[model samples]
Target: MAPAATAILRETFGFDDFRAGQAEIIEAVSRGENVLAIMPTGGGKSLCYQIPALMGEGLAVVISPLIALMRDQVCALREAGVEAGALTSANSPEETDAVLDAIGAGRLKLLYMAPERLASAAALSLLRRADVRLIAVDEAHCVSEWGHDFRPDYLRIGDLRRALDVPLAAFTATADEQTREEIVARLFQGHAPRIFLRGFDRPNIHLAFAVKNSPRRQILAFAEARRERAGIVYCATRAKTEALARALQEAGHAACHYHGGMEPDARRLVEERFAREDGLIVVATVAFGMGIDKPDIRWVAHADLSKSIESYYQEIGRAGRDGAPAETLTLFGPEDIRLRRAQIDEGLAPPERRAMDHGRLNALLGLAEAQECRRITLLGFFGESAAPCGNCDLCDAPPQLFDATTAVRKALSAALRTGERFGAGHLIDVLTGNATERLRGLGHDALPTFGVGREFSRSEWQGLFRQMMGHDLLRPDPSRHGALRMTEAARPILKGEAAITLRRDTIASIERRPVVRALVRDEDQPLFSALRAKRRALAEAASVPAYVIFPDRTLIEMAENRPADMDAMARISGVGAKKLERYGAAFLEVIAGEVAPLHPARRRLAGGEAGPIYDRLMEAQAELARGPGGTGKPLSCSHAQLARVARLGAADADMLERLLGERRAERFGAAFLEILRAGD
Candidate 1:
C-alpha cells in the first residue's frame, strides 16, 4: 500500500513525498478511518485525501464550499492526469453532462460538489449511485457556527456522510478548540475522529506590521518595489478596496478590485483574471481570500488591521503557498484598533462571547506591539510556543521602548476628570491644555488634569494613549460613541503602582520602507516577462486561469533554467507529464527565440497520445473542406469536437456522424474514422 501510494504521488501528482503530516493522514484515511486534519494553508491538505482517493475504490466525494475552489482542484487534478470532475452550478451544460457521464461510467476517481448540493434530493440520489468510498470535506471549519466563515449549508454534510456510510476526512486551516468541538458535534455527531493538529506556524512567510503612516503611499511603495509579483492588498471596507485598487492602478500597477458587493459575474472575472495573470495585485476585502487556491501568491499586505489573529493568519497564509519565501505587511493605527473594538462590541453576540472576541482582538494587538518576536506572540495565541523568529519586523528592527507610567497616568487622569465621555481627540486636547469651545462649554478647562500633562507634546500623548489601548488599559466605549474608558487593567497604572512601556516611534511616524527582496534577479526579469506573456496567451485562448496552464514557480524555473528541450523542461518542479507535453515546446521556443505557429486547437491536445490523431483528423477534414465531391460548401468541426472524437476513438461512421453532425460528418467522417482506427 505504501509503495502504491508513493508511486501515485510521483507519477500522478509529480510529488516525490508527502508533506510532513500528509502521509499519516493519507494512510489513516486509506485504511477506512475518519480523519480531521488541521493543516496550515499551504500544508498540502488536499493531497491527504487526493492520494487516498487514488488508493481507495470507488469515487472520493469532496465537499467544497466554493465553486471556484472545486473548479480549480478539478482542473489541477485533470492536469495531473487524475480522473476528477466537479458538479457545480457554475458548470455549463456540456460540463455537467461530462461529469455525469464520468460518474455513470465509473471513470471518475474524485467527484467534487458544493455542500449545497446535499439539499437537493436529485443531487443526493445522484451521489447515492456514485459508489462513494470516502467523503472528503475541504474548509471543514465552516460547519461550526463559532468559526469566522460559518455556512449553514455545511450542516448538511453530516447527513450526507451517514447516507453514504463512508469514512469522512475533513480539512481546514483555522479552527480553535471551541470550533473544533462544534465541528465534531455537528459533522461527526460527537464521535471522535483521527485528529491531526498540524502546527499553525507558516515560517516561510515573513510577518511585518507597521503603524499606518501615509498608508496609501506605504502600500504603493510596497507594490512599486515588488513590481510584477502576485500579491493581495486587503482593505477594511468595500470602498477602500476600490479606492486602493485605483490608486495602485494609477501608480502603474496591474491591479484590480474585488468585493462581495460587486456583481457575481464581475467578481468572478476578477478571480479568473487574478488566477491567470501574474504580477496582478488584487485589492480586496476579507471576502476575497477564503477560497483562493493560487499557490504562488508572493505576498499579502493588509492596508488596515485584520479583525482577529485567526483572520490575520488566514489572510497572510494566502501568500507563500508554494513554500517559497513570501512576505506580508499589516498596517494598523489607533483608528483601526478603535474601529475593530467597536465592531466587536456592537455585534449581537452574548456578553461572554463578546468578551472572548475582545480578548482575541487584544491578542492581535499584542502581536502588533510586541517587543519580542511577533511569531512567538502570534503562535502563543493559538496555544503554541516558539522562539523568537528573526523574520518579523520587531525581531529585525526592535522598537525603542520608554517607560510611559507617568504619561499614561496623566492621560488616564484627564479621561477620568472629564467624565470619560469624550473621544480620543478631545481627551488629547484636554491633556495638552488646549483651550477650545467644547472644553469651555464642558468647563473641563477648570480640571486639574488639564495643563498638568503639558510636559508631553500632543502627538506624544496620542502615542501614549494608543499604547494604553494596546495594553488593554483603555478601551473605546461603544455605548458612548467611542469615548475613552479605562479598563480594570488601568487601575494599577493610575495609582502609579504599575509601570507601562511604550514604543517611542508612533505608528504614523515610522518612515516609509525600502523595497522588499524581489523574487527574481533584475537580469531574469525579461525572461520571466516573456514566459508570463506566453502563459497569458495560452490561458486566454484556452479560457482557463494562467496558473492552471503553469504556475509562477514553474515559469520562474523555466526562466532560470532556460530549459533547452522537453527532457530539461520535464525536470522542473510542477512540470507534470501533461503540462510538459502541452506547454514545453512553446516555452522552449520562447526561451530559445524560435518561432512556432502553434495552432490554438492543436495546442490543447499537444502532449497527449491523441495529439497526433487530432492532427490527422484536422488534416482529413481540411482535405474534405468542399465536401465528398469537392462541390459542397466548406464545413468543419471545432477543435474540441475533433479532440473529443480522437480520444473517444469512434470507429463506425454512425458514431463519428453523431459527434460531427450529418453535414460535417458527410464531409469528413470516413477519413476521421479511418484516422481513429489507424491510430488504434
Candidate 2:
C-alpha cells in the first residue's frame, strides 16, 4: 500500500541497517504490536515509529510534550525527505490549515502534536479522519501519575489511543516496576504491552553525585576541574537560577540564566546560545530542560536535590547522548530534603502519596551516601538489579569503612536517654561526651554511656549520624527540621536486627579535594584578566555560558601550556571539535609563537586534567542539561559558595556554627568541611 519500511531506512534515512532493537519494534508495529519501549535517551527510539510510518498506508502520529522537540523532530524528518509536520499551540491558522491539507491529501507521512492539544474536539475529529496508523509517545512516562515528571493531562493519552484504534508505543528511560505498571494502566487501559528494556545502562556517561556544601564555591571548583567541557547547572527557583547565573558570569564564565519569568525572546536567545555553543553551562530552573536537542552537553550538576528519583534520572539522561563521556554532579544540602518534603506535603497528592514520596527521597539520600557502585544503587532504585559498575566514583575509588556497631549503639542510647527531644548535635555531644552547657544542664555527664564514645572524635560521631540517617534508622522530623526521631527501622539498629557498620568517616577523597596547580602563576592578574577577556568573547560568539566556552581550568591550562597553534591547542585536552573550530584562532593568536594544528583525531580518557574525572562529570552534566530547570532539582547556594566552604574544614556543629552562619553552615557546613579536611 505504501513504500516498504526498509526502503525508507535505506534510501530516505540513508541507513543500511537498523540499530539493535529498531527493526524488531518496527516489525512489531508493522504487524501492529502494541509496544512499550523503555529505551535509553539516545537509543534511537524515534526510528521505531519513523521507519514504520514510512511503510504504513496512513500518517503516523507522534505525541511529544516538548514543542521544541516536536519541531526539531519534524524538521529532521523533512530533511530526510519525509513529509512530516507538527501541530502545536504556536501554529497560526494558516499553518494549521496547511498541515491538515497535507494530511487530508495523504501527502503527509507523519504528524506530531502534544497530548494537551488532542484534548480539543477539533483535534480529535481531525484524528478520526486522518489515517493515523501508529501513535508514538516520546517521554511517555508522563502518562503515569506515579512518574517523577508526571503530567495529569497525560492520563488522557490512553483515551486518545483507544479513540484511534491504533497501535501505540509508550516510551521512557526510567520506569521501575511500579512505574511500568502505572504506564500500562494509564496507556493501555490495564492491558500489558510488549515491553523492551534495552539494559538501562549508558556506559559512555559517568555518574557522580556530591552533597552541596557551599554550593557556589564547590560549583566553581568542580567546573574549574573540567573547564573546557560543556555542562548544565540546575537550580530550584527562578530567583536562585537568576542569581547563580550572574554569579557564574562574574566568576569568569559566560554563564546565562533561563527561567519562565524571562521574556520569550530572552529565553529563545539563551536556548539558541546553549544549543550552538560547545561546553556551554546553562543556569536555569526546571523551566529550561525538556526535549532540547543539544547533544554535546558533557555534564549535569544540580545545586539541589531533585523532587523525585524519576526527575533525577530523566534530567541526567540528557548528557552523553552522542555516546561520549560526560559527567553528572549534584550538590545537595540538608535543606533540600526539607524543601522537597514541604513541596510534597503541600501538593494535591494524598497522605499515602506524601509518605511514598518521603520514602523515595530517603532512597535518593541513601544512593548519595552509598559507597558501593553508584550505578548499582541507581539500578536497584528502578527495580532492576545490577552488580557493581566499576566505572562509578565508588568503584574507581572505594571509600574507607569501619564497624561502628558500638558507636551507633552509643548514639542511639544517647538519643533514647535524652528522650529523643534533643537534636543530632546534642545527641552527638552526649556520645562523644562534649561537656557543652546543654549536656551539663541535661546532666548527661553523669550517665554510663556519656564519654564512653570518647574513643571516637566529635566529627566521627557526626559522620555516624549522617550514615544512620541514610540507613533510615533516624529521620529529622519536618516540624522540628529533623529533630531526632526513631523510625520503625531503628529497632533493628538498637536491638541488632542488623549489624551497623559505617563508612569510616571518609569525608576526604583526594580527587574531591582542590589541588593548587604548581605550574600556574599566583596573582598574575594581567594574564588572568586577559584569560577572562578571551572567555567572554568566545562565550558571546558561541552564545554559551562563559564557563562552557573555557572553564577556569582550561584557561589555567592554556596559560601554563601556552600552545602556539590549533594543533598544539587541540592537544590540550578538553578542547573538543566545536571549540577548536570556533575559538581556535583567538587562542592560537595568544600562543602564536608555537602555532601548529594538532591532529584532529579525537583523544581518549588518558593523561590530562580531564582524563580521570571526565565520565563522572558527564553524568552530572547531562542530568542538569534537560529542558527548563536543567535538572529541575532543589537549590543550595551558588557553586562559588560551596567551594569556599570545602576549602575551609568547618566540621561538626560547633565549627559550622563558628565558620558558617546558623543557617548557612547547617546545610553545606557538614559536607564541605568533611571534604576539605579529607582532601587536606
Candidate 3:
C-alpha cells in the first residue's frame, strides 16, 4: 500500500534512478531500522533519509550541527515542493510559530534542529507533541570525541533518540574506523545499525599537490586560469585568511575572507555572498566549509597544508558537488609539515593517539610524495583500492625521477653530524657549506658532513629535505622545537644498503603550470559570460545567492546547448520546474542575443534601485566632462571611480570631492552630489 521509493525519487527529486547504495539505505530506513550511512561527500546522502521521510507516516526530525546548513536544506526542500522547516536561534518568532503550527497540524513532513537544541527541556516537550517518528543525524561523526569536529552538544543526540523511541539514521563523509565505532556505541547504544559503507572515491574531482614556491603567486595563477567560477581557498591561520583575501582582491578577483574570529554577522554575510555570487573566492581558515551545501564550487585550493588527511578530504570535498568536473590544488612545504607535527605532538591526546595522528600525517605526506598515482594512494589510505586515475597531476605528467640514494644519505649524515637538534634551515646551511655564526658556535666547521653537499644549490638541498620529510625518513622533533630527526625508514639508506629514487623535476624547479583544464571551449566562452551576467542580475534582484538563481554547472549547460525555448531549458539538469518557471525566459533571451552584456563595473550595480542611479550618475558625469562653464579641457572619472561614489551614496559635495579628489571633484562633485540626493 506504500508508495515505492523509485516513484518518489522521480516525481519529487526529478532523478531517473537512485545512486549506488541510496535505494538500499532508503529501504532499510523506511523499514524502521537504525541506519549508519558512510557516503562520500556529494554522493546524494540527503536522499537516503528525505525520500524515506516522505514515504513514512510522521515528521522526520533531522539533527544538524550548523544553522546555515539547516536553513539551506529547508529552503531547497521547500523549493522542491516538500514541507520542511528548521528551528534555530536564527529563526524569527513568526517562523518558529509557523513551524510549531505545522507540526501540531501534521502538515510538515520534515523538521530540522541543531543538536544543541535537544539539551533544552522546552524543546523536548514541544517535540513530544509533534508526532515525530524518525531522527536523522547529519555530520554524525561530530558526536565522536576522536572526530575532527567534535561537538559537546552532539552527546545529547542518543538520549533524545531513546526518549523519543524513534528510528535514527546517521550520516557523515569523513569517518575512520575509530570514529565509526564511537558513533555506533554512542548513538545506537552498542546495538549495531545497518551500516552502508559507500566507497570514498570522487572520480569527478581532479587532484593535485604542489610544494609551496611563491605561494601567493601560485594561488593567484590558479585563480586566474578559472576566472569567474566559485571557489574556496583554505588557509591554516586566521591572519593568513585575511592577508590572502586582500592579496586576491587587489589582483581583481571578487574575493573575501572568513574565520571564526570574525563577528557572527560578518561571517554570515560572507557565507551568503559565497552562496549567491559567481566567480567569488573565499579565502578562509578551517573554520569555514563544514556543512556548506553549495554544489557549483568549481575548485578548492589550499594556500597552506591541511592538518590531517581527514581534514584535507573534507575541505576539498566542498567543490563540484553537482557531479561536474571540479579541480583541487594543495600546496605544502617543509614549514607546513613541521607545523603539523608540532601541533600533533603538543596536543593533550594520549601517547597512542599522538602516534596515530603522526601515522595519519605520514599517510598524507606519502600521497604528496607518491611516485605512481596520487588518487590510488589517497584511496588506499581510507581502506579502498583504486586504479591509477588519469585525473590527477601525477598521472597526467609523470614526474621525472632519478637515483637520489646518495643525496638522501648525505642529507641524513648532515642531520646526524649536527646532533639532529637543528631545523632544516641550519641543516641546509651546513650542507651548502654556508658558514654562519651559529654553525661556527656549534663547532660544525669540524664536522665530517659539513660542506659535503655543496654540489647541489641551497634551493636544491631544501627540496631534498622536503622529499625526505615526505618519505617519512625525516620528521621534525617537537620536543626540541622542530629539530630534524631520522626515523627508522632512513636507517637502511644511511647504511648504503637501500637505493632510493626521488622526483628530479621537483628538485630542479617548482612547476608553475595550471592544474585545472578549461571546462568549456574557447568558442563558447562568450556565451558563458553572457549566462553569468544574467544569473548575477537575477540573483541581485531576488536578494539571494547567485547559485540560488542557477549554479555554474547549469549556466555552463545553458551556454553549451544554447537552449532555444522553455521546453529545451527544462531538460537541463538543474532546471527544475521552479527554476525553469522563474528564470527560463530571461536566460533564453540572453542566449538569443535579446540582451546586451553589461560592463563588469555596471554589472555590480545592476538589478536594483542602484542600476538607475548608476545610469543617472554616468549621465551627470558625461554632462560635466568639459566643466560647468564649458571652457576647460575634458576631464572625467573612470567607471570604477563613479561606481564607488554611487554605491556609497556620497551625500554632499565635500564627500564626493573627497572620493574623486580636488581636481576632478571641482568639475563634477556638485553634479554627482545632486544625482545621489535625487535617488535618496
Candidate models: Cα lDDT each: 0.84, 0.70, 0.85
lDDT of 2 by residue, 1-680 (tens): 13486656644553445666777777887778889988877666888888887776898899898766776677556544579999997678998898989998999998999988877999999999988888888887887675556777788889999999998887887676777888898899988899887766776667776655578887877776766556788888888888887887787777788888999879877876776555577988777777765555677778887877767777788876655556777766556765776687667777887888888877887777787888988878766788777656677677777777877877888877877777678887787768988788878888877887887776666666766776667767656655777788877768876776667734332235322223247655356557767777766664445544654546666777777645456555446444555566677666554344432221222222332233222333344334235554433443334333433433466765665467555444444444445544
Which consecutive 10 residues in model 3 have the weakest lDDT in total?
602-611
Q: Candidate 1, overall lDDT?
A: 0.84
lDDT comparing candidate 3 with the true structure: 0.85
Which stretches in model 3 have alpha-carbon errors above 4 Å? 1-3, 562-568, 577-680
Q: How far is candidate 3 from the true structure (C-alpha RMSD, Å)?
A: 18.0
Best by TM-score: 1
lDDT of 1 by residue, 253-292 (tens): 9999999899998988888888877789999999898879
Q: Lowest-scoring 10 consecutive residues by lDDT in candidate 2? A: 599-608
> Residue 611 of model 1: what lDDT?
72
lDDT, candidate 2, residue 130? 89
Question: lDDT tens digits, residues 32-109, model 3?
Answer: 999999999988989899999999898999999888888878877776678999999999999999999999999999
Scored by lDDT, model 2 comes in at 0.70
Q: How many backbone clashes does candidate 3 have?
A: 3
* Model 2: residues with Cα > 4 Å off, grouped in runs: 1-19, 92-97, 259-269, 341-348, 383-387, 444-447, 508-680
